[model samples]
Target: MVDSIRQYLSWYGFLFSLGLALVWVLMRIAAIARADVSRYFVDRLMLWISIGVVFGGRLGYVVLYEPEEFLAHPVRILSLDAGGMSFHGGLIGASLAVFLLGRASGYSLWALADIASSSAPIGLLCGRIGNFMNGEMYGPPTTLPWGVVFPSPGPERRHPTQLYEMLTEGVLLLVLLYPLNFSSWSRRHLGSLFGLFLIFYALVRIAIEPLRADNWNYQLAGVAVTAGQIYSLPMIAVGLVILGRSLSAARLRDRV
Candidate 1:
């Protein structure tokens, strides 16, 4: 019993799931509490968007990475109970929800995106912690002292890459988004925050793919990649285009 308990602790069990649930609840609470005046805060919108993200993310995982198995059992694709969701798909789904909501409510798409971006890190940080608990995306062989001996089927010590991502894409992004609200940067160019968030996230995710444990993407021209990186490239490109347009608009506004 003691050994089982110790293994559970080291493996990161229910504690991780609890952390995600806690953050999600807190975000809902925050939306409810701030709904009085903040255009960005809406309980229904948040709930719907969350649903879209989870559903889309799961579908994307099967469609992009494991289509063969899913093809064999089409019904299993919808069974998220087994656990598989792609971050890129979730982003796309959430963005679609936001777009629809924004158009209906007369809110700017990027402005809504900015509001969502601020809250993104919370989910990301929690999700990575959950990943650490699951021991699914462990890193390649490493001689570093901090290397983890995962109770996973492998005997090799690997880098805690998930934690690394949590720090950069989650914690650091949150810090960056805070001061951005007070700055005039976005005011001059609406969507600057959103664009930057997407671009930065894509760059960071792509940079970390090399350290990933598995090469889950198709190889193109002798370059091995992962599904995560492939999905991220479009985000970076779109962000760059948005950034350029924002700058041009700002310049035109100044001229006018």
Candidate 2:
């Protein structure tokens, strides 16, 4: 069943693009329900976010993962056909777009961020599933019963880290955040959901880093730490700061 699905996905390049489309739809729905924003605003926001995700994800992958190669062939930066994207980069780009749009539209930045964050897990889920279908992002060898034998890495059974992320970062996150998005308290606190999203995603990525095989070259000073883990540390810290500030502001408002 899994192989058949993978073959189907391979036959047509739909899963990743489908994921983006779903994300856009989810965001638009969220904007209407949560913010009651106009159609024009939603359309504009989606456009900016799409641009951010593509350019930012590509640039991030180039700079962080393969700077030397990209520098040697700079034109390859525009060639997304080669397939490299960084989630962290996309998050940064999307956040920037949200911030900019919020400023221009006179909407609350935190509120817009909350809406995006709430819908982000859907994208993560789809992207990880796409990775699984493509047989990429498999983890190190494992003797576990459920371990999968991916095509590129040759016969040894490996932990399906993409599926792991699909569960933790995608399914779990969506379950956790989606309800909070509709909660009165979360709405009042504004960026609380976004803060939690960051903290949870970073923690999960850090936890899953040890299982992944591709980050060996990015290990830190002979330690087992991968670049993803290193990048995630800041996310955790920032999440904590944002969560704290949002809660504090909410409390202050309540007291007034």
Candidate 3:
């Protein structure tokens, strides 16, 4: 059973399926929650989101992680089997997709964002596991009892950063989303869940970057920091702005 499962879900195939599955789940949840929303509109939005994530992730990976290789062979960017994707890039793409779709469909932008954010942790959780299974993105050596010795990084025990991401970015993310998911007030208060997800996920990514030895590093103002952490800082600031505005608006609505 295990061998059969492994054979079917190779890296390229897994990523393709993951994006589609998450979109399906997100649209289904939204449909169930607001039965009045047109299912056909949801389907159109899903197509955009899926395309955004795939292309965005791929291009971002090329630009951020492998600019030289991409420049040398520009056509290589289309090679999905080579395996490179960026989470931040995909987020950017997906957000843009939603914004455009919302504008066309006459749906609330933040409301769509909130619905997607509430459920995206499931994809993050699964993605981290995919990383672990592929024996990629392991962390530096650690003496902790729970450290794993992945086949790629030699026999030394290392922090399983993938699992850490799964725990912090995935399970804990779901926990934070739980209240927003069930509360009627939260649903009506557009952007609350959307901002919360960005803030929480950004914080988790920044915290975890330090533990990841394989992360891309660059020097900034005589200080060395991982690229992941650098990218997350902007997300944190943006999230704070969105969250503050959303809260203020909700308060104003309540008063009225």
Q: Which candidate gets the maximum TM-score versus the true structure?
A: 2
Task: Choose 1 or 2, whichever is better by lDDT.
Answer: 2
lDDT of 2 by residue, 80-192 (tens): 54445888889889998888888999878888788778888988898888788778778989999999999989999999999999999999999999777556777788889
By lDDT, rank the candidates, best first.
2, 3, 1
Where does candidate 2 have its weakest 10-residue lDDT segment? 4-13
User: Candidate 3 at 213: error in angstroms?
Assistant: 2.2
lDDT of each residue in 1-256, candidate 1, tens digit only = 4554445445344443453455455444433443321434455567667777777788878877788898898877655433457888888888888788777876566766665665677677877886787776779989899999787747878999989989988888877763565556755677777788899899999999778785576786798888788889999899899878888999999999
Report the lDDT tens digits of candidate 3 across residue range 117-136.
77778777878887787777
Query: What C-alpha lDDT values do all the predictions have?
Result: 0.72, 0.82, 0.79
In model 1, where do residues sit more than 4 Å from their true spots? 1-41, 78-83
* lDDT, residue 224, model 3: 85
TM-score of each: 0.83, 0.90, 0.88
Cα-lDDT of candidate 3: 0.79
Q: Any idea what lDDT model 1 has?
A: 0.72
lDDT of 3 at 29: 70
